[model samples]
Target: MKHLFTPYTLKSLELKNRVVMPPMCQYAVSSKDGIVNDWHYNHYVSRAIGGAGLIIIEMTDVEPNGRTTDFDLGLWSDDQIAPLKRIIDACHQYGAKVGIQIAHAGRKAEDADIPVAPSAIPYDENSKMPHALTTEETKEMVEKFRLAAERAIKAGVDTIELHAAHGYLIHQFQSAFTNKRTDEYGRDLALFGKQVIRAVKGVMPAQMPLIVRISAREYVDGGYGIDESIAFSKEYKDAGVDLIHVSSGGEGPILAHGKPGTHAAYQVPLARDIKQALKVPVIAVGRLDEPVLANSVIGNEEADLVAVGRGMLRNPYWALEAATALGKETEIPGVYGAGFSLKK
Candidate 1:
């Protein structure tokens, strides 16, 4: 009977419902320093108002140079804390749990043409070929990630997610296709990911949970695969990560297999495989827009949690509405309740 509306808990934080707001970039907010603005607050507030159970804030960069766009959110400075506090408080008021994803874009940082990466490679044709991070500079990134996690804690966020995948910084170290150096930090992909986790935990409260978003499969030849991903997930679990949000086929803009044209649950298999490998829970996210699809996945134990992306953007109150359509006991907002119909 477990469906999309089931209550899930990780660590000490309890989610009111199962729907999660996956981190999707909103590039219109800021350019240089990544200051949180009305556009940022209102965008997330609207989603919370739509009735998501847990609201994971967008990829908020841990360093200024970590930005992927001129207008991405940044938590590198203390000044950024208050603006985030507002968003966190708003989500809390709506009975939704809030978690901030602190990230470092590495070679993907968009502001400057000269960015840092494990090796000198471009994420894409438009991407800049980055310089390798020196030993001291690499250590600096560790501190930046740690301080960002600490700031998120101070902002009263329920959880902190390290952006380790999706062609970002930790991803640079995690993927061998882009990271070709012979140093301990380069070829040993697991070590760099471990350091990021260790450093983040060092600054976080003992009670707070840490989540890692990983692209379970590169879906490319000679790239990282599920075996490597699960092995790393085991490390994440042992390193004390509370959950591994299973997603796949990234580290590049377009996959060789063609993602935008793939089947609905193309990525769910990654979650299923990783779930079997590790003791920690897994969250599956792909084209899970239908209630039956989501329910069937969770009900059949394909994944412990389902993340609705484009579907959520298309319908903010999707969880409540889906539960309603499925005949589950869930409330409907007065404004949209009177005439709403699953059939229509």
Candidate 2:
């Protein structure tokens, strides 16, 4: 039976274990230049050291204004490559494959002078109204994703994740609540995501996988849900997406169907649904901090991988501890092993 410690292989990608540290924004970039610094290096490298099989870097914007904040990582410039390369190289040294979540914040870009989205919709009443992208500019945005993928390949990422979740640029385009355009984009909600995926894949190595994160169940009244998400997941898989990182909400929370419960493995069902619907691998995330619960998802064959978010943030050594708890054989650094019971 598969467990969290089982080595997972997708195409040419071989993970030492199934523990994935999903992209959690560090907001540690020292300048608006979007160049990674010591904090990012230390942050990601620590997780790799802690024994995460895949350390997916945070929502790295494809363009400056696409950022949720000025502090988020960016791949728009060649200068940003080396700093990110530094992190990827360090993670590789620790036997962890590193992937980057290339994204655009769109209407949710809190720090932009004026955020842009599929339409001129404000994320919420408190948020600033965003400028709508012209059809030509929308094409330009797709090119930006392609360029970002090229830079990520240059930085030597083992894989690349397109951030389409949490009310970000791509999600804004996918969710009907945020996108109210009269163009081809709004008519076909999956069009933008497909274009971006195709664009990113064009520059990526054939063996490398592309993961797309999606909010499978948006809480708002008119937002997309599991069925719609499944339909789009199929479209994405057809467009070269190798995996789907299942997440929920972020489209201006309405919670009319009731908010998602704050329980362990809350989003595993979403992942499972997509996997079953598309026969595609999925990374189950959201409050899967417990070792047993995380392992259960894999053991039950519900998901291909498990992503630990806040749990990892609070304890960089979560994976190491999980290994010890589950009695899974792992190379815990000698220095850290002393902290675990030596009786075993």
Candidate 3:
């Protein structure tokens, strides 16, 4: 049976194992220039050294104001490319294939003096109201995403993940709760996301797979659930998405009726549904920190890959430790081999 330690591949992206370090923002950019600084470098490269098969860089915005905060990473300028390339090169040397999540925070861009979104909706009562994009401006956003993908490719990424989940820009456009537009975007909820997929795909090498991260189930009232997500995911798949990274619940406050489950593997079922419905590979994430539980998801064919976010934050060598705990042999750095050997 396939397990967590098994090798996996998608198009040009090859992984030594199914262990993925999902994009978790560090908010560590000290200069506010959106460049990858020492903290960002050390944060990702360590996970690579610790044996993460795929280390996805955090939610990197396409424009300066598109970021959730001033400190978030951005690919808006050529200056940012080299720093990111440096990190990717280091991660590659340590045997971890790198991918970066290109995104815009939309109404969720907290630090923007005035944020932009599909509509003028504020995320909540305390959130700032955003300027709805004009049709022309909306089209420009697509170009921004395309440019970001180009920069990521230039920086040596094996794959690129569009951040369509977590109540970010793409998620805002796709979710009715957040997107209240009446133009072409409103007429077709999936249009923005589809355009983005096509735009980003255009810049990527044909052999390089494109991953779209989607919140398969929104946990707020009137927010989309599995059925709605599957439909849009199909549109995305048809538009050139190669993989779906299934996550859930970033729209708004979780209502009592729509509260997301806090249990381990709670989101696996959603990932499975998307995988089955779309007939595509998916990376399952959400509280799947335990080695045995993560292994079970792959062993049962519930998902294609497993992402350990919080667990990885707690231990950079989470993959190596998991290998030891599960009795699976993986290539450990010679210096770290002694630690794993103790398990035998």
Per-model CA lDDT versus the true structure:
0.80, 0.91, 0.93
| Candidate number with greatest TM-score | 3
lDDT per residue (tens digit) for residues 90-205 in model 2: 99998999999999999999999999999988888889999999999999999999999999999999999999898999999988888888899989999999999999888888
Which tens-of-lDDT digit does each residue in 298-342 have in candidate 1?
888888778888887787777777777776655455566664554
**Model 3 spans with C-alpha error above 4 angstroms:** 342-344
User: What TM-score fits each model?
Assistant: 0.94, 0.97, 0.98
Off by over 4 Å in 2: 342-344
Candidate rank order under TM-score: 3, 2, 1
Compute the lDDT for candidate 1. Answer: 0.80
TM-score of 2: 0.97
lDDT: which is higher, 1 or 2?
2
In model 2, which residue pairs have backbone atoms overlapping below 3 Å?
none
**lDDT (C-alpha) at residue 268 in model 3:** 96
Candidate achieving higher TM-score, 1 or 3 = 3
